[model samples]
Target: MTQTLLPATSTESSSRPVVAVTGADGFIGSHLTEELVHAGYRVRAMAIYTSQGSYGWLDHVAPEVMQHVEVQLGDVRDAGSVRALMRGAQTVYHLAALIAIPYSYVAPRSYVETNITGTLNVLEAARDLGTARVVHTSTSEVYGTARTVPIHESHPLQGQSPYSATKIGADKLAESYFLSFGLPVVTLRPFNTYGPRQSARAVIPTIISQVAAGQRVIRLGDLRPTRDFNFVADTARAFRAVGEAGPEVLGRTLNAGSGREITVGDTVKLIGQVMGADLRVEQEDIRLRPEGSEVMRLLADHSELQALTGWAPQLTLEEGLRRTATWFTDPANLARYRVGEYTI
Candidate 1:
């Protein structure tokens, strides 16, 4: 059965193009929803339905922004709900997925359902409804530990973890839809995105939240892996860039990053520097990935995204870290996270 969608809250939004976003309640999705609103588009945001009526991060958005967003309670895993979300939408940004790496280890089947099957639902809905554009989300983890520095779009995909494997499957499915059905899809693969509203499961937030909670010795997993950490704002813009770009980007996979790399240890130190804390690291066995599953390095070659959409990361690592620290240090924001507890 088809689910009925709520009408736009404001009459002014009726004139704007309808852009549907799955997972608008998530970290990057919330930022992207706000970005789309700021760009004068009417947003249809899909938050996973729950009895508690929680809209995740969308519930915390400013009232003014909320006025332009229509929240639909649905799941990407359900075809009917996904089709309902996409109906009458000009563009669909598919971001819903189970993304925690450690959790993937515990429940690989959930990852398959949400990431792979959920993507299938999005593609089918878009194809059936004739949506103009579908901005499908991909992760740099598909490349695993980089075989070469500055991983490009053409770099070989290596799924070293269950999470990465599911994403790889999803990415391939997106490719097949574009090639097989001529669906207008652009895969925007973002490197490690970090900033405000990030869960403590992530390295940057983990370090920040611990230090904010007055912990001098930070507990973390292996600190030797390197990453190209893109700020959430820049990542949100990249999604819009691809979603709104012309057909030149159709069926193409693009990378979004700052083109800079920093090791986990150095990143921790940098966070300490930005927060004015002299922090120490204590490795925890539980936090460590299986020996072979750990991605030792990741650096993105985002030139293709720039050449195609003129999008480049605008924030420096230190500046982004500082901004993140500012948000995580806030009493209310810090209170949301269980500091000192290892999050999967």
Candidate 2:
């Protein structure tokens, strides 16, 4: 029997929602879950089921936050499990997916299963359960190498790699569900989101971990590529804003970004400045993505979201980097990652 959960709307006056987050164990998902909880929401977290019962990065968080959450072990790929988890919940943030582009090359089928089909399960559950709002997650990679500066939601989606292709498929499916079934859903396309709890698989964490551990030579690839990075808190706030926006912003995809772009090379130098370390960056051939697969540039057009919700990122790049460096420097936190070899 499924327990009855309150609608997110019913709890609005309390500055909270009885919300559920899929992929609450992963980086961005974990952070979003925490944000929702901190906002006074009754959060039920859906972590991927495993024999090890690992909560992923969520395990590293302060225990106080973890104590308040109701943990439901399930996999998004399983339609029945997803439906059960959505029981009585009003708002759903679907962030569970296989996201490594490099790994997708070896396991394209897993990408399709988790990214597309898994999203399908969440949408179906939300549609049937009458969830008040569903915020679907999308990545900047879906836009591919941008043909224009500051890419907007209107820009054509180019599937440059199998990973992006699957996400495009997932985003379109979410749109179709919203239009065809009247399922209240909003698509959130986030530029690179970085902060504490991010894994070494991501470039931000990879760079921070290597630099913090006293690496005399930092290994990197394709430093010329520019990326727009939004702090995880800002990204999480965007999700909350979409939920609070109600029906006015339904069935639309909005970008969450700082509206600023910087090259990877420049980011490294800035981090060095923040960390007060003088280190040489060396190009590693193994770290480079295939020519066609790399997204050479990404700058976000956040005007749409800003005009609608009146929210903007508050964290400066330096402050964000300093916080991230601090998290990685702590031996307790840094041990979560193996600094010797590359993750993805």
lDDT of 2: 0.85
TM-score (C-alpha) between model 1 and the true structure: 0.97
- TM-scores for the candidates: 0.97, 0.94
lDDT for each candidate structure = 0.94, 0.85
Report backbone clashes per prediction: 0, 0
Prediction 1 global C-alpha lDDT = 0.94
Q: Write the per-residue lDDT of candidate 1 for residues 214-305, one digit (tens) a residue.
A: 99899999999999999999999999999989899999999999999999999988998888999899999999999999999999999999
Q: What does candidate 2's lDDT look like per residue over 144-190, in tens digits?
A: 99999889999889998999999999999999998898889999899
Q: Which parts of model 2 have CA positions greater than 4 angstroms off?
A: 1-16
Report the Cα lDDT for residue 30, model 1.
99
Best-fitting candidate, scored by lDDT: 1
